[model samples]
Each structure stands twice: as structure tokens, then as C-alpha cells.
Target chain A: MFLPVSASLRQFARAVTADRLAGDELAGAITAENIRAGKPPAAAKADLFREFILKWREILDANSRPRPFSSAEYVRSLGPPPSEARLVLLLNDICGLSQRDIEYVLDPLSKPFAELLKEGRAVIARQREERKALIVEDEPLIAADLKDVLENMGVTVVGLARTADQGAREALKSAPDIVLADYNLDGQKTGVDAVIAFQDSHQCPVIFITGYPDDVLKGEDVEPDFVIVKPYRPEAVQAAVAHCLDTERFFAIDADSANGDL
Target chain B: MSNEKSSAPEKRVEKLQIMVADSELAMIDDWRFENRAASRSAAIRSLIYLGLELTKSDPDAAAKLLDQLDRA
Candidate 1:
């Protein structure tokens, strides 16, 4: 599909002209080189277009037979293109990509489809991990919003607590997979206090969200993956929760102890 | 999306992910070849997903379905 391209891409495509790439057509290697120089998304996509052409070329080569093909060979036969023609056809077929995008990011070379597909598979696997979490906020509406976010992603929210003592009790009893607590809670306890207390009984990860920024949290008593500043995006919260759950180098507190390891 | 749901509901085919050691993979390859069958990788993956789907039902029916599918 045609994608808009930035000028940066075209310059990179020009850089890789020394290769045996046909003068009549852009080379896939150009895409790879652009990525090497840190190409933009447009250029990266151009690379896929180049890759498809190359793969089709190879398939044509592998299917060729010297003699005229019999009817049996019809299914295997794909009319081959000389180098220049192949590039031209592919460009025409997958047009819409801006010249700049094709040049800088996806010149003619980029990661193979296999590698990109593998990366997608790994991302899917990462998103499926099981996690135990603690919700440390005192506000009912905010806490409930966070809970829905977690559940939609297939994570179980084990308990809800308004105060640090209550949070600590639920944390110790249920031993949630992770703790998500507000920086300031009702009465005497802060989210930081709840996190410390919960850690004493369980080894789940903790995340703190507060209205105030680094000007204050840098000094407070805290142990958490990240201190999420408030007025948050749900995407950011989900991402942080996903990261905390994925961080397995720590919490060697037995894989099956509270929440099973991803 | 509609076509996806219209498959044989009782024996729905779905994807399953499996990871095995190289040695185990070789053994599976050998088993598939000796049986004059296509690569069992797809079958294995399908069976795994099918088994999981069956288990999502009640325990008694799950056991029965698993047994019927020869996947217990």
C-alpha cells in the first residue's frame, strides 16, 4: 500500500545506489540501509514492498524449468521478470508510498517478513502474561476505572482497599500479583506505606500514581516500578501495568507462590 | 468475523502455541514421517487450542470432550 513519505527517506535511497540495483528500479537493500541509519515509519514500510518483490523473484527462479512446461507445470509456473521489470511491477502494484518514505525507511531493504512476524508473535506472548496486582488508591471511581482497564486486558484485580491498613491486610491475605496504589490515601496512610507493608508479606510489583509530579515524589518514601503522574492516559497505565507484570528478573519469590510467572 | 464463527462448532480448529526442545521437535518429525502423514506441527498446535477450548466448559463435559478427541 502507498504510504506518505518524508524527504529523509529519498536521501537514504540515493545513498545505497552503489549496489547492483537496477537503474530502472529501486532496490530492497535501500530499505535495509535506511533502517541502519534509523529510518522513519514510511521508509520502513517501503522496505516491505521491496521485500515482497524479492520473494516473488526468488519463487519464480525456484519454479523455472528449461523446457516448455507441460500442463502439470502450469500450477508451478510464474512468469519471471528480469531485475528491472520486477522492481517496476512491484512499485506499480504497491504504489501510494511516497518517494521519500520509500527512500529513507524502506529503501529496498528492511527486516525480513519472518523476523517482523516473529516480533509480532513475541508481542502477543508478552501481552498474555498473568499478574497479581494491588490497587492502592482511596478514590472509588478512579480505582474502579483502573480495575476495568486491567480486566479488559485479562488481568484479575484481586482486592480493593481504601486505607493503608486495609490495603496491607488484603495484600497480605490475598497476596495480589501487583499493587497499584494512590500516592495519597484517606486518614493516615499513603500509597507508599501500603506498598512497603504489602511487600513484607508478598513479592508483587507496586506502581504509584499521584497528582503531583517529580518535584515531590523524588523525596517521598517509595518503592515502585514507576510513579505515574496523574491526569493519566489509559494507554500509559495499561503499558505500565504490562511492563510491571513482564518484569520477571526480580520477584524470585517462587513462580507459583502468589501469581504464576509469565 | 462471521465466517470465523461458522466453522464446525463441535470441533472448531484454532491456533495453539507450543515450544519444545530441538530433540523433541526431531522426535515429532520422525513420528510424523513414519506415519506417512504431513507435518504434525499444525495438528499438534490445533489440538492444543482445541483442548483448551474444550476445557473452558464444565468439568464433566470437558473431560468427556477431551476423551472423545483423544486429547485427555
Candidate 2:
């Protein structure tokens, strides 16, 4: 199999097992078996994947021995255990498999493949819809407005702060999934400083609502991915928040993929 | 042989040069072997195609993934 295909398989295994070590062992065993079989280089990928599904229960049972860590630890770090529908989505969306390939791999489905995929997307969308944000704008009015906007979009506003110090304290109290901060705060430290501090303990997406985009962009300290210029519309904030959440999810997956050997 | 030569017109002719760190090179080599690409060049082209398609679909996610890959 190609490197991408192998990587995809590894990722799929990881998602299904929700344990890095187990996923590595499972994929390694399957790949070794395939090599021993002396399958042709052009062997069908779908067949290999189907074999993975067929062997999952046996392999998982074999590897269920006690380890240094608990499965709950792994589940907490990653998201919840993936359902079959989510597994299909991960294969097609994250693993880059074609729909036809998935259909072949998951043959004899109770429901149509399209329906399962739609359900998967809906589950993912609902998860994304529920998010938490920390707003750090010095102006009371602006901070309230930001909170209202996020709440309207179904994101829980965790905290509102007028200075970098307050923001850091709030973040320590309750870790936020995302942060929206104004460039100039009530104290000497700018939003960039506050973001850096927040990230020191917890890493999350930061959207800088700054009047001077140039200052934030040119600042050597922190380079934020999402920045809304001052006098921004509600739509702009909403769009930035949505994009940041999506990017954060992708980062989480990438980090999980890189944690262990394939 | 005649059919192969006839298809040569569609073959890639342009050249590009770039540099990568040892770790990155190792990843490329691993990818090349896994995909069974004919050469490093072929593997790199395929990677580029994949990256472009991802970027087209979700620019933010693609950019973040690229950044992670660079750090990896």
C-alpha cells in the first residue's frame, strides 16, 4: 500500500480503538500479515480495510491487557469513543477514502452508506455547534456584545475580562476552548501578551479583535491565525469563530496522528 | 513501445527545486515507500496534489495541518 493509505489505516485504527498504543499494534499486525501473504503491490485497498474490520474484535480482545495507563485517560485526551457512523466519517473525511472505497470496505450495511455518512456529519456538526469561548475586551460594552454574539451562536461564554491578568486568572479557573481578545487591554499588557500567557497553560484558538491589525500582525511575540479588525461586524466574528473551531479540530487530529508509530 | 512514446507528450516536463530537513525528508521517503511511488519526484508530486485538494476544500484546516507537518 502507498504511504498515504497506510497512514490512513493507522489513523482509522487509532480513532476506532481510541488508544494510541492499541491502534499502533493493530495496524502493525495487519500490515505484517499483509506482507506475509505476499499480496501483489496492486492488491485492492478495500480488501485490506475489510480485513481490518473483520479482525478488529479479535485483535482488540487480545490487546486488552492492563497497561500503565487507563483507557479513560486516552478517551479524555481524545474525544469520546467513535461510533460506527463516526468511524465511516473518519475513514472518508479524515482518512481521505473515496465513498466507493468505503462502500466496498463496509459491505452488507444495515442502512445505506449515504445515510450513515449523513448521520456522521450531523453528529460532527452538533459537536462543533457546542463550544466555549473566553472574551477579554477592556470595554464593558464590547465584551458584552462579544458574549451575546457567541451565546447566540450556541457557544458558552466562559469568562469576560478587562485586562490580561484577569483573563489569565479566568482561563486558569475554567479552561476555554477558544479566546477572543482585544489588542489593547486595560493594563500594560496587550492581548498578545494575554494570549501567550493563556496558551502557556492551555492551547486554544485566539481571535484578536484589534483596531490596529498592523500592530498585531507585525508583533514578533504572537502570531494569531484569526484576527478581526476593530469595528468588525457580528458576521465577521461569527465566521472567525467557526473557522477557528474547525481548524482546532484538525489540529487535534493531526496531533493524535503524530503521537505514535504507524 | 509506440503507445508509450505517444503518451510521453502528456508527461510532466517542468522542474522545481526545494529543500527539506532530515526529519521531513524521512517522512517523504516513508510516504514514498508506502505509496510505492516510482521515485521521490513522483511521491512529492502526489503529495502536492493531495495538499492542494485539501486546501481547496478547507483552507484553515489545510493550513493548520501543513503547519503541524512542518513541526513534525
Maximum-lDDT candidate? 2
- Cα lDDT of candidate 2 equals 0.62
Model 2's C-alpha root-mean-square deviation from the true structure amounts to 19.5
Worst 10 residues of 2 chain A by lDDT: A66-75
The sequence of per-residue lDDT tens digits that candidate 1 reaches over residues A1-262 is 1213322122112111211111101333334445567766454555654553443344445645632222112212211122232222123222334445434333343444334334422332344435566687789999999888777666788888888988999999887777888888878878777777767557666666777543332212344554455766664466456545543222333334322223
lDDT of 2 by residue, B1-72 (tens): 111222322211122357899999999989978975434655676687777778999999999987997998
| After superposition, candidate 2 runs with Cα above 4 Å error | A1-129, A248-254, A257-262, B1-72
Report, in order, each candidate's fnat. 0.00, 0.00
The reply for model 1, stretches above 4 Å from the true place, is A1-130, A215-221, A251-261, B1-72
When candidate 1 is compared with the true two-chain complex, its DockQ is 0.01
Decoy 2 TM-score against native: 0.40
lDDT of 2 by residue, A1-262 (tens): 1123554465456446543334544565577677768976435667767777766644334444522223222223332234557656656654446788887777756678888877665543443435788999899999999998787677889899899988888877778878998988866898877877877677676777877654543313365545566676675566556545542132233344223221
